[model samples]
Target: MMSNSTGLLLHNAKDDDDEQSPFEEVAANISNKDDPTILCLTFRSVFIGILLTCFDSVVFQFFAYRTSPLDINIGLIILLAYMMGEFMSKVLPEKIFNITINPGAFSIKEHALITIMATSGTTTTFAIKAITVQRIYYNYPVTHVNGILFILVMHLLAFSIAGILKRYLVWPASMIWPKTLMSCCLMRILNIENQTETTETRWTMSRSKFFWLVVLFQFLWYWFPGYIFPLLSMFSFICMIAPHNIVFSQITGANGLGLGVLQFD
Candidate 1:
């Protein structure tokens, strides 16, 4: 029942579309693949990475318990980091007393590394429940020293195990780090340094405009689920039928072992 001519035409169009896979972007940007400058493991990178990680961790921890959990987007982080790095590069003296301390330029490599460090710390602290259970439920003795040590040990143990196995499953260059790749693309699109061209009106949306548009949309839309009509997030015909059936609703309700069948109403 298929037409061979149409299929052949589609195949030919695909071949002519400049078949460049986005995942291979990390490999494509190298003029000399052996050059190590792209790694961006400088002193400035470490300093910025640490600062951003602290900020990112705070943002994530603050939102962890909110009814409408909000994630600080990586693109936003990259934008902020770029602005801060640029400000320092331009305003800060590159050398003090003829001793060079600052690079005076923020490389894409440095930006990427900073983003990666921040991301690692932003994940939800899974060991929080253990501390809570010990303190609140069991009424066991809990001190700041042991609590901090317990968290560090748990976090480091997972890191150590994964790191040891990373050479096999994670450290390979062939593995496309999806999150890193996305961050890279965002950086490339938002690169604002060393520009000399005048702005032009475009048919397609620019990244800056698109970013603000998304922010505006999400800000306006979330109110419906968070306040105005909270039931939009989780609704079921079963709930409407038997409003008083506590047992049935418990099993098929939002945040209550339900399948999470969402409905508009």
Candidate 2:
């Protein structure tokens, strides 16, 4: 997950700022015959692309159910949504339909927002699964506690594995995750820096707005579980306690939160 965000930030294909030396000759030749109309058109098209992504993400979240067509994986849906967006841009008429698709509309802020939404759903699903597994199995008593422990251990193992593989997968900069490529292309379209400067340090206005929005939200969101509503963070503990009662146990199983049957059984 951290690597995903890192890729969004360091997509050098989209941002020339990663290069130390500006391609001055290339820029000079291009600027000599620069077309403002083309630039505007490209920007418009890219904006459409970002909008399409946002729309697809939202639609998938709304209609995607826990089973059947709705049961599709979020990551798969995101990829499909991006493809659909790309397709629409190419096939859909711009003026006749009064809609345009452009990859330039995607910014760092938009990417982060989309990612957070996508990840939040995935996390919730995993958490629910962990709860289910605990209640169904471990009939030896203290099943709830054991289940919580199981979840923690599994997450720790996942993180550990990710850490072990990070050096090989992420450090060399050659692991071209395809989704990363799509994101980079969109980000590049969004950036407005003239191609002359290889390393422009100034933040684009859109990027600045997005950066602060994320910062503010991150600071504020953590406060709820971290301080104000601390119990929200201890949901698993609450779940364990509630399961000690018969009513809660019935409710748990009914709500699909109990792990009454383990596969091993």
Ten contiguous residues minimizing lDDT sum, candidate 2: 27-36
Residue-level error in angstroms, candidate 2, position 137: 7.3
Predicted model with the maximum TM-score: 1
Residue 10 local lDDT, model 2: 75
lDDT of 2 at 225: 74
- Candidate 1 residue lDDT tens string, 189-226: 55532232345543456565676688799889888988
lDDT for model 1, please. Answer: 0.70
lDDT of 2 by residue, 1-265 (tens): 5697788877854454332213343332222222333333343334444565465546555664446434435444344444444455466555544544443333333333443344334333364354655556744334567766866787788779989998788544334455544444343333333233336645444543564476578778888878787655534443465666877665444345644422210
Q: lDDT of each structure? A: 0.70, 0.48
Q: lDDT: which candidate is best? A: 1
**lDDT against true structure, model 2:** 0.48
Question: Candidate 1: which pairs clash?
Answer: none
- Candidate 1 displacement at residue 44 in angstroms: 3.7
